[model samples]
Target chain A: MPSSEEVFEKVQAALMDALGVDDDEVTPEATMVGDLGAESIDFLDIVFKLEKAFGINIPREELFPDDILTNSSYVKDGTVTADGISELKARLPWADLSKFEKNPRVQNFGNLLTVNDLCRYVESKL
Target chain B: MRWFWIDRFEEFVVGKQATALKNVTYSEEPIDDYLPGRPHYPHSLIIEGMAQTGGILIAQMQDFHPKVVLAKIGKAEFNSIVVPGDQLRMTAKLMSLQSDGAIIEGHVTVNHQPLAEMELAFGILDDSFGDTSFFLPGGFFRILRSLRLFEVARHEDGSPIQIPDYMLEAVRQEAAQ
Candidate 1:
């Protein structure tokens, strides 16, 4: 298993390659979409590069659990309830969602994800 | 006629992953049927090609005992245009496999440039549940042989897996024809 520092370095490299961002832009606090300018489609490239770098199979569901998103108990009328946010937090403990916690939206959670979140997730997998 | 979106698999592991190739030609029916004057592979067919690649890999992993069918294309995205003379290389990696179904992650590239990415789900067809035969035609094995699937395949521990009996039978049937 890699140290957390090593995982952070690798994760930064992956973000640079996937999003074509500069070194300064891929900070721990930088959000994937809002801060780093990652489009919805860039997540696939990020996942692919992360898998190659870590030599681990990260299931698509692991990135965003489909069952939670689709479950009626979590989502109601396209909005995520408090229960949904709690479940997402439990699953994605790596994310620093202090801002999202204030007012979370179902469609915008991807945007709320941060570079540090991915680094922590990959470290856990390793 | 036996219809296959992908021509043949070039590289494969029993259950883990696979790589296949498809050639886009002007003579093919879909290219012409999709648009009379403008000939380009449609996104839908491209997705089907990915699904077929992943579906067959899952089926082969189960040793072909249960018929595998494309249950859902959970996600698909095309990034570039594919036209005649383009050779698409599709790679499928198994994500999760259950007794009843599987989920696969796949990607396609042309000349090492990204073409598409896909998430495909497959269900095992059970005849006891009023299932019909969805097996690829016997000729599929002939194409598999030509592409060296059996020669290239291996398990995680680097040991070769025995060719399934049904595949052997398919080859025999193709030879008889």
Candidate 2:
């Protein structure tokens, strides 16, 4: 399988193909529905991308149902906040420990992480 | 929503089938941010729609308890991108099950044109360490039904299909003394 970064890039490319969007569009900040006008079909494409990229199962619950809710700040481990910013912090000083983590739309989609997020974790391990 | 509604189980007793519809609306919040007139429906939502179909049935299988988390997705194929205003008709059928997980086959079609579809295996996990959380009033099931979205149908003949005997056996978790 490709490295985590490679997998993310693959997902990015696949989503681009599925959405007919430019490569620059799929940033971490972009919500699948909110930022990309992605309906259910495009999302399914992303899952296919993620599954192929990472070699794992992404069940329905793996990806949060509502677009807005998936992007919003969530309480992780029932304590720490897991918005994107905090997500960056959580990775550096150890991936998780009460400090909330970004719940990747990454159910068993392999590694329980998004491309960039997985990259960060991989980097942290070094 | 992403999953397209096709039909509902009106005749089936144990097994049920349902359909969802996903219209790629131009006015969705995301389009405004994109440059020009580019628009498309996100893919994950489609699966959720299918999952909702499967999820609801799983809930029905489990008597709507111990919420079924999508345990696994197998062999998903994207025939094409689903766009706004495109009528996507989705269908889900009970495949198989075990004490730990279930397999359901679902597909997505737009104007009868196949777009994306997959055969999914979902697991009913305990509330601990799982995404398939039970009692999610705001979850997919409520949203789809309350909104009166999806054409709820159980079988191909506009009738409910009998629940697969094995699924009934697997779903019976309480164990009789």
Candidate 3:
């Protein structure tokens, strides 16, 4: 199994290649969409690169829980409900959802994924 | 005025790699018109040629089921200018293939010299994009036939890649019409 640092490096490289961002810009705290300027399509490219780098199969839902976020049962108005937050916490144990929990707007969810979260996810898989 | 950038498929391996050739000639309108006096092929068209080469390779993997579109050009680097009379050979290798998208690494060469390199991303559109078909049935197949894609294409097991029945049926329907 790769160490946490190694996993972070591989994830960083994947993000850099996928988003055309520099190494320093891919700091652990950087938000994928906010800091790296990743679009929705870029995630597919990132997933492909990460899979290749770590020799792991990343199911789309594990990284992007679009279904959960979009489902009416989990969302009220534009925000994710308390149950939705619980589901997100369960689905994305690797991600830090504390900050997002305060607002939990479905739109805000896209920008919540950080580089550190990605590394943790990769480490979880390993 | 066909949008075809590639002249012919020189090599094709299903779901793997493809190589196509484009012979530039001064007779082409773009050569003289693009740069006024200097008659070199536009880099944009070179990228288009690579996209076509790579796009078709990705499409064939799914028997052209998914509406494959070039979503991004991750990287494009031109080492030398291509002039008329230059025979450009473009090879695209499938680097990654997934349900939502794919990536291909492409290289363009002229006379055994590296001319350009590209990394392209292709997206497979789902039904949300609308149920309309992008091409008239059998239209793309006719172009593929003209390019001799079936003649050169082969599966990994070395078996010949046959034209999909739907495409053939479309051809027959068009012929009957």
TM-score of chain A of 1: 0.88
True contacts kept of 2: 0.00
Q: Distance from true position, residue A99, model 2, in Å?
A: 40
Specify the CAPRI tier of model 2: incorrect
The best candidate by lDDT is 3
Could you give the fnat of all candidates in order? Answer: 0.00, 0.00, 0.28
How much lDDT does each candidate structure score?
A: 0.77, 0.53, 0.90
State the DockQ of every prediction.
Answer: 0.04, 0.03, 0.57
DockQ of 3: 0.57
- In candidate 2, which residue ranges exceed 4 Å CA deviation? A1-126, B1-16, B30-37, B127-133, B136-177
Q: Against the true structure, what is each candidate's TM-score?
A: 0.55, 0.43, 0.90
Off by over 4 Å in 3: A1-6, A76-79
Q: Candidate 1: give the clashing pairs.
A: none
Alpha-carbon shift of residue B95 in model 2 (angstroms): 0.9
- Rank by TM-score, descending? 3, 1, 2
Give every prediction's interface RMSD.
7.9, 9.0, 1.2
Q: Model 3 over residues B1-177: C-alpha lDDT tens digits?
A: 778899999999988999999999998888888999889999999899999999899888878777888899888999889898899999999988877888899999997799999988888899999888788659979889899998999988899998889999998988899
- All candidates' chain B TM-scores are 0.85, 0.65, 0.96
Q: Give the per-residue lDDT of model 1 (tens digit) for B1-177.
A: 346678777888888898988888887887878877888888888778777778878877766557877776656888887789999999999976655567688889987899888877676666765755555646556666666677777888888767777778876877899
Output the number of the TM-score-best candidate. 3
